[model samples]
Target: MSEKNRQGKRTARERLAEEREKQKSAEKRRRVLIVGASVVCVLGLAAVIGVVAANVGKDDGSESAGPVVVPSGAKGKDSLAIPVGKESAKSTLTVWEDFRCPACKAFETAYRPVIHELTNSGQLKVDYHLATIIDGNMGGTGSRTAANAAACAQDAGKFTAYHDVLFDNQPEETDDAFAENSKVIELAAKVDGLDTPAFRTCVEKGTHNSWVDKSAAAFRNGGFTGTPTVILDGKNIYQDQTMTPAKLKQLVQEAAKG
Candidate 1:
């Protein structure tokens, strides 16, 4: 078998143990696992390139379906409800990611328009599943820190806002940590009526940590070992450099038609 297939044969526990040897914490290991998984990943679907939307929370005025329901207690967004399309949308595209990852940053930037096109036009719905499985020390805290800030952002219903800011000002994980660093507090400050104090305190104490950490654990359990891992209507979309906006849109549209 090929190297990818060779690696794929290992169970999550086996891969996780190996990843832990490389990273450390189960959280970080999980992030590493995801990155590893995304490289080859449980494969399926087409590849596209482009920008997508990043909104927060639920909207009452919009027609079609309701809000995206998060199983582990839905969180908040910085600005508006995460810019989702139809709540009851037949086609749901969910992303399991770590904010600190560089690849995820690229994917988010590329996915913006695609998500907008699909959701805004009411053809699809998307929800973000935070996994701070990786640490900043690797490529940056794009994994953990971003996930934490996202949780705080979600608390204030500013997840999408914080998400954009996090990507816009992504710092070097090795040089500066965003996950447990002061930047998270600063980001929390930017959101109006966001209970910054509570968010800061919560993050510091890890009050809402379970959501991010547990999700990372779930990612591990779900057979997804990576950041920016996209699940399209229960199907895994595995693409490395090829996972562009056009590709995501194509899969979503094709899935919708099916």
Candidate 2:
């Protein structure tokens, strides 16, 4: 081969190697940039989550900071449960409920009759724990206010009747009607002897607001996902799709026999 041709071939091979090295460098830089951007995105998301968590903590603290005026004759841990039947009843139904929750209202509507019958017959007792989750989610005080009024009724020795009246006249979840003390007092007129001055004062002043907040905190801390969490004799009957008022009555009757 001619010397000039050999020299030209060597130069061409050197140029090709240089070109490949440039491409490799460019690819490495591109990968680094992509990783950096991904890290930045992750950090940004974490910061946002932190801010949201802090805000939630602050709100919860503010809501829960007050005197917890438990209702008269309240039962259970922290006196957060309103009892509705003879203590000697064979079965106890634990109900975690929210006043402004539509599902809770539905459950009450469907089960109220059977529950009343069972309680009246001294076969079953119910421990009602009130939560204000709807107030937290929907941005209102109706749930807490209504709960306070119910507590006042408990003090008046008319909790069951007032509770039924409240459920029967529950406003829409989005409607803050129950937030108005007058509205709750108006509903109290439906319950005999529940519209007295002390009841009105308790309702207006939100005497049990802190207690209600504590109950809501308990509902959340208990790992419950939603309202109307109905547990019959330690079994969560509400989670069973086949559960009905008749089934509930049958369960209570069986418990009574045992």
Candidate 3:
């Protein structure tokens, strides 16, 4: 073949190879773009699902469907509170907590002694409000079931004992172990006279589920946003950044003085 023809053929072959390489690179770029968009869309959908699941039991001004069985000493607008101090006490400390909340467990473990001292000394009256926001966020019946069992303990006149045990034995945040009625009853056995057949029946049948629902509703409607929400003399101490367990005592004493 002529040298000119040979050179032209070689150049054409090289050009063809370059064209194929460019096409492959363009196809690879298109695939990458498609994969990235798909990933973003999937993440967006997952985020939406998470938000919806977290708000499943949120209070929307709607009442509970079941009958709300308020405990004997329950107080509050919807009768969903358990009071733990003398009526004549000057300081009112309101606590909103969820049994499944790790933060609530931390607060309870850290401040239980001071809380007991104040309540025992009649220097403070604490109103305990149970919330099940964990159940809403984590997708389990454990929060509701545990709250109902606590109410049942109140019926048996053992709220404080059972309440202490519940926090002491709080499972991992995502663990739905508390959802089992048998497990709740077993925990009740830790509190004297709290494991009675009546209490068992109350928990097994979820007699106070409505009250738990109402408590959650009251929590949301009370303009609170999270667990371990501590309020003293109508002031939200949890909102204060410098407030510690010691500061809590001072705040309560000051409130009592007023």
lDDT of 1 at 36: 66
Model 1, position 228: C-alpha lDDT score: 65
- Cα displacement (Å) at residue 218, model 2: 0.5
**Can you rank all candidates by lDDT, best first?**
2, 3, 1
Task: Give candidate 2's error at residue 145 in angstroms.
Answer: 0.4
Minimum summed lDDT over a 10-residue window in model 1 is located at: 51-60
What TM-scores do the predictions have? 0.58, 0.76, 0.74
Give the top-scoring candidate (TM-score): 2
Q: Give the TM-score of candidate 1.
A: 0.58
Give me the displacement of residue 94 in model 2, in angstroms. Answer: 0.3
lDDT of each: 0.57, 0.81, 0.80
lDDT of 2 by residue, 132-227 (tens): 776666677888888889899999999899888888888876798998999999999998888899998988778888888888778777876566
- Whole-model lDDT for model 3 versus the true structure? 0.80
Across residues 1-258, which tens digit of lDDT does each residue of candidate 3 receive?
999999999999999999999999999999999987654442223343244335545633334657778987999777777999888888888899888877677677667898899899888898999987777677788888899899999888899889999999999987989999999999988887678889989999899888888888877777665776788888877666556667778877787788
The segments of candidate 2 whose C-alpha lies over 4 angstroms from its true place after superposition are: 1-62
Per-residue accuracy of model 1 over 19-126 as CA lDDT, tens digit each: 877666767878988976664322222221111111111101112123322322363342112334577677877786656555566666656667778887777987
Clashing pairs in 2: none
